[model samples]
Target: MSSRESILPTEADFADFRKQCLSSDNWANKYDKHGRQVWVEVHPGKKKNQVPKVHKIKCKMVIDDVPAATMYDVLHDSIFRKTWDSAMNESFDIAKLSNNADVGYYSWRCPPPIKNRDVVTLRSWQVKDDEYIIINFSVKHPKHPPNKLNVRAISLLTGYYIKPTGANSCVFIYLSQADPMGSLPKWVINKASQVLAPRVMSRVHSAGRSYSEWKQQNNPEYKPWLYPEQSKLPMMNPAELSIQKADELEQVDETFKVDAQECEDSS
Candidate 1:
């Protein structure tokens, strides 16, 4: 069957996300990572409009010898996330909104001294000809709420545009705007947010290149939510998660041991 025939998003849904995926604005501060061009721009807020800081990021890179479908798989597949995204703590669909839309939960591992942040998002994805677009925004759901351990961060907008460049490669574009809902000033937050996206985008390119091989070993049978014809899969189990607090605890111990060794050697 054809890929367009195999995916499930509606024409209206595809149109909406495609618009956002391709929407362009003047972006500044361009740099390079992993042989890909990366840049970030902060939209200055006007208090009269009630807008806080908005961080706009863009990254472009070509993954050699990987089909666009495989890159799409890397971006949308939840089961194979842990293989490339080291910061992702947990992620899964909360409910199927439609054949092509769903609510998702994602939690990330933050460095020490700052608690982890999580978000609930509504996602829509579709493949048109050789181009694929997946876009999402933060939302609130009753079943999932702010927990004691992790703070909830609002994702104003997050999107991806994947277009085939050749028989074996594609260009990946990522855009993100988020509000952590903290006491930090808008300028302070925007600057801090700028540092995160480039790192995330760099990791994404590395992951996209390895996706095909990773999926083959991890869970080749797993079908994505975009593929409605496939059988339904359950949400990830809390116990089934590969990265847990135990792993964080081990890292803490390792740091402590290193500190003790440093003192002993110095004395």
Candidate 2:
């Protein structure tokens, strides 16, 4: 029921996410739509490492009909993700590191002229009191190498926090500071927080509304995320994954099509 002591995403990581979620200090409000709001903050890259400037994004909404637990399930269900995540090109669990942690792969479609992107991440989840936290960061996996099909992106920190508000209502917050590895236009970066973030949030909200019905007919009792004992995934050694660095990946400018084959090859 318990995992090995200490992991890549320590409790401090979760605490920092929670803190940021609750505060709006430096985050600039981008837009607000039907109670769902988005904010963006640009942080300069460190001088020594030459890290790329990070765009910290926050999107939050309140749903009166969907429970927090159901939202948690909606986010974790890869099978269900196929039905809801329209932009997703590929996604799957690679290996399990613990009952509450794992490494996974995800690739998504980007708008025309922009090359598609993918990432391998060390993901972990936890349930504490009335809140549920799911967080992940980019990690290099030896067994799964980035192919030419998609530029390897880096998720410095990305995750969700869900908290119950009422019997059937909850607050859902998403926070991300990821670098889509490639030379991208300023407009593209602006669109991410302005247009893309809200669209993704809307999709998730809709997914939560209908997830309960879909789960009942499917494997209703199977929830590896909540009940890790039910996971059939093979155990993986934590030593195999290292924190992914942006400098290591090839920086291809996405303004021009990297490969036409990537679009055709996508399933």
Candidate 3:
């Protein structure tokens, strides 16, 4: 084997990587920091000799709400997760329930544009009447394996911390760790996380805010259906048919007018 020197990623490189990861822009070059080696790999794919690995992502938010139980309920409740958690598109019913707390087996489907589907079995434990909650989840990739292009593991663990900030306020913290699986390159993992993690976290925060507002307005006691409605997102309007047709007609008229002018000039 030929001897080779490792390349380190510079600040500029990291900045450029961040920009690309966040916006899907192009990067001129890629480098590795710790390995201290430079390779000519210039795409989003797995690395050589890199096995599927797990990574942890943590997020925290402060919401205006009291009653630790309510905060925990909003965050840990399976029905509520469908509303706020960006990773979860839709949820299924839990067949088995433990008597001690709200424990059951649930599965989730990934959002659009991704071909893979994930099925998760999770359980939640409420600590001291919702003061805090311990959530454990394991993910299984039914479609892909560790060696595939989209290598994903079959297990993950997530925890939630909810504490009362004031009489009418609370703070929420979430931590998730999972293996991406396969031989994914480190740069790809970092890039994907750097880009998507923050956005997803932001969505979760926004969802929390919306949920809190809805709860305050409709107080579950007065309206039991409030939760369901809060979870349902409003559909976007379709493209305006009349406007498109009008634009097409304008284009046709302009073309004919130009042709007539050309003919008159020629004559």
Candidate 4:
């Protein structure tokens, strides 16, 4: 059966379904987790001519050996991000650094057949100490309207707190609070969080573990206090990478060419 012929609900029917789904008392329950509960609290503020939604998300992870300061470096390193962050498809160096902290920009392209659209974000990272770091990110979506969506700026605040658990092990706590734009039904957003949050968090934790292992294997004398220069790595230029397959095909020759003498001999 054709995909278009498959079971499909009309706009009104889907709207009714979403309305029923969002009305549930557990609509807010989508933010909860087991052992680690991250709450999403929507603020009661709105512009006179616009609808605004403010929410927060908090979660935690644990890492071994690597201190929070070094982790901050790892987080800012656009090249290292692909290792764990599935949401971010491409990143580039926007500017060179003068100190431990650097300003950089990243572009996110969701994994596809979804027709992944790109969103640009500016990030700032600051290390409080060997045990704490803070990251502030702002996502820019030119396609989104500024008035109706509270997440127009896509401002995200994240903090990482590291503490020693053992001689070679440490506990990593991650907290993120952000507003994602779109006129999506609250229930649909909640449902997506229920299904994908755990998997995403697991990926992040695994990323930390992998980085810790890499640090041990390579920098046995690794000092948690030092800001590593591991950020320098070749990244795809977005302009060149953004070309569509059709454009690439246009550059190729269509005619098939073969040596006439060789063809005749073979025949």
TM-score of every candidate relative to the true structure: 0.73, 0.88, 0.47, 0.51
Q: Which scores higher on TM-score, 2 or 4?
A: 2
**Residue lDDT tens for model 2, 1-267:** 026444467778788889998897777888888989998864445463463456678889988989999999999999999998887898999999988899999998876777788989999998998899998888889988889988898888888999999989999999888777678753455455456676678889999999999999999999999888999999998877788888888879655634322231111
Model 1: colliding residue pairs: none
Once superposed on the true structure, which residue ranges of model 2 sit more than 4 Å away at CA? 1-7, 42-52, 256-267
Candidate 3: lDDT of 161? 63
Q: After superposition, how far is residue 45 of candidate 2 from its true place, in Å?
A: 15
Best by TM-score: 2
TM-score of 1: 0.73
Model 3: ten consecutive residues of lowest lDDT: 258-267
- Error of model 2, residue 150, in angstroms: 0.8
Q: Could you give candidate 1's per-residue lDDT for residues 1-267 as a string of tens digits?
A: 023432234577567656654555545656666656656654555454654345655656656667777778878777777676777778877766655667778887655445566777777777778888887766556567668666666665677888988888777777666655433344555655555555666676677777777768876777755567673744332222211111122111112111111110000
lDDT of the structure predicted as candidate 4? 0.39
Relative to the unseen true structure, what is the C-alpha lDDT of residue 87 in candidate 3, on a scale of 0 to 100? 51
Q: Write the per-residue lDDT of candidate 4 for residues 76-129, one digit (tens) a residue.
A: 444446766756644555432333333334434422211222223333333433
Give the lDDT ranking, best first.
2, 1, 4, 3
Of 1 and 2, the candidate ranking higher by lDDT: 2
lDDT scores of the candidates, listed in order: 0.60, 0.81, 0.38, 0.39
Give the better candidate number (1 or 2) by TM-score.
2
Candidate 3 per-residue C-alpha lDDT over 41-79 given as tens digits, one digit per residue, 9 for 90 to 100 = 233455745533434444445566345456565654455
